[model samples]
Target: MKDYVIGLYEKAMPNTLTWREKLECARFFKYDFLEMSIDETDEKLKRLDMTKEERKALVDLMFEVGVPIRTMCLSGHRKFPLGSEDKTTRERSLKIMEKAIDLACDLGIRIIQLAGYDVYYENGNEKTREFFLENLKKSVDLASKKGIILAFETMETNFMNTVGKAMEYVKKIDSPYLGVYPDCGNITNASKSLGEDVIFDLKKGHGKIFALHLKETVRGKFREIPFGTGHVDFNEIIKTSYEMGVRRFVTEFWYTGEGDYKEGIKFSKDFIDRKFEEALKDK
Candidate 1:
């Protein structure tokens, strides 16, 4: 039996494809599951409003295709962040959080990866941080009520660029529903900027880590970097995270629309598979 589950981020495939097509592609790529993306865009945001029938259809499609959407990258808060200084935006953020939790419950998604940011595209201050923490507690309460896991994604911003920083908020909330699903690439970049050890930072979260985003990044770049062309040491990161009790992983990359994305997907899956195989060898 496999020691772990590996999933592909939905954005790793072209957005032009339907959910069925995406799940088919994920299965063809030999991925265990698909990590759905609910980014800040209106098109993605509207998915939260999907009807019960549509949700059931998608779930049925999963069983038929054999590739379930087990996780969600809920980055919608990057636009309507809970820590926004504006009252209307904060209210919208809470509403979005509620809708996202409800959607996760309907979709049978176990974990929702939250963007670790108090405020994006706006100046952050103590007030924003306070508002963010306040709303975050409420959000966790909602997730707890539904028994859905809400985990933070280690972002590229200094506010929460490392697993340790994410854990600070996780500890503050102190809810089983609120944990960390860190991005390895972002933490790698954060290590470079903060002069800290990536593995050590990861260990800080320890039992609080639910999953990991195995993305590639350079010293300054955090997105769309070709695997093996960046500085991230997948071998060590996966090994450390595995030892930390993380059993789920998702390859986080974007389609650049330059070459065959299928090739990219296959390559990423193979690369991560090798890493997991190496990391878990004889463990």
Candidate 2:
């Protein structure tokens, strides 16, 4: 058995495929699991309202395909941010949180990676920040009861771009259910932009880090950068995170309608596997 788990992000494949097809593709690429995406799109958001039979069918499909979705990237809050100034939006955000937790429970997903943002579209002031904290505490309480982990994803925004920044909320929430799930690419960009070291930033969330997103990024760009074409140092980042006790990783990228999308998936897995091998060889 492998010492750690590696998963593919759902967006890494074409959304046109069904869940069975996606799971087959992930298994074909030798990924240990798949990280389900619940983004800001209405289509993705509708997944939370899935009926019991639909959820059961998905669970059965995982068993049939032999690859399970072990984590969720819940970015739906990016649209209805928890710290919105409008009461209606804030209420919607909390509703999203509750439904996400329920979906995670039904799907047997262990961790839900939350987008770390107080307010994405609007201006973030002290009031918004306070509202964020208040809602965050309530979210954690819901997660704690269900025994699901709700981890912060270090986002590209200035609001919560670093693991250190994410830890502030984790510490404030003070629950085992809340932790950090840093995106290597985003943190790499944040550190370089601020003249800081990525490893140092990761160390700030040492024990609180539940997972890592093994993505590729260059200066100023946050998404869709092909692996190995970017400036991210996957080796050192993986090494630091591994030593810090992170055993789960998900390759985060998009499938931009490439004809050889399978080839792209294979290349990403191989590249990240090499980094993991190098990082954990001596440990």
Candidate 3:
């Protein structure tokens, strides 16, 4: 297996940090890149509204800091799910996705990690699933035209909670731009929710698993916490995924603004490095 380049998620930086601070943290942590996010907030949504010049300036700053934004996590689905029943809301969701895709192209982002929610904070049914797939097809088409990859992240939801399920869509879409971004922590949570041992079929994706969101999750409680404090079997995940040809990982967690974040960064990076090697050497 090839070596992996680990990235810090956008939430790794506290909201108080300026762009410079965030980039500095990435550089200081010696990360290969940083993951940008477009979630359900006026502040985060501003990235979609930035002028082309402004976007260029931000990208330039990242280049100066040597911390490229390689991927985008479009978490705005929690607010505007594609499977929303309301026609207006579903249309808005698609618009947000289109705008995010445009911004991603401007920023040189290679992948857009989409949330797995067909409908968030709302009931889902056959019609909702149909709407979700319909909107996703549109997004995939636009992404293909723009030369961008849209990988669906395994979520803490009843829909698309595993890589296997995501593969169903990948096959249906039949586009290289569409794939899976499985989160190990979310898998653990989903397993607990189902009262069964649900493990990710990393190899089943046939290397279409574009990225992995590495995080810790205490089942039935939280998905983001300190490393090794959850049920996630990092050893198994890394070993299985690496053998399946996964060579990219994103350490997803929110900055707590507690002690120096450098400690957390160092911990995360080193842990990933060590576990990656450990998994490779196992058996």
Candidate 1 residue spans exceeding 4 A from truth: none
Pairs with backbone N, CA or C atoms under 3 Å apart (clashes), candidate 3: none
Q: Under the 3 Å rule for N, CA and C atoms, how many clashes does model 2 have? A: 0
Tens-digit lDDT string for candidate 3 (124-177): 999999999999999999998899999989887768877778888889889889
Per-model CA lDDT versus the true structure? 0.93, 0.94, 0.85
Model 1 weakest 10-residue run by lDDT:
273-282
Q: What is the per-residue lDDT of model 1 for residues 157-230, given as tens digits with 9 covering 90 to 100?
A: 88999988999999999999999999999999999888888999989998899999999999989999989999
Quote model 3's TM-score: 0.94
Give the lDDT ranking, best first. 2, 1, 3
What shift in Å separates residue 82 of candidate 2 from its native position after superposition? 0.2
Candidate 2: tens digits of C-alpha lDDT, residues 1-283: 6688999999989999999999999999999999999999999999999999999999999999999999999999999999999999999999999999999999999999999999998999999999999999999999999999999999999999999999889888889899999999999999999999999999999899999999999999999999999989999998888888899999998999967789889989998889888877888
Model 2 segments more than 4 A misplaced: none
Best by lDDT: 2
Provide the lDDT at 237 for model 2.
91
Steric overlap count per candidate: 0, 0, 0
Which pairs of residues collide in candidate 2?
A: none
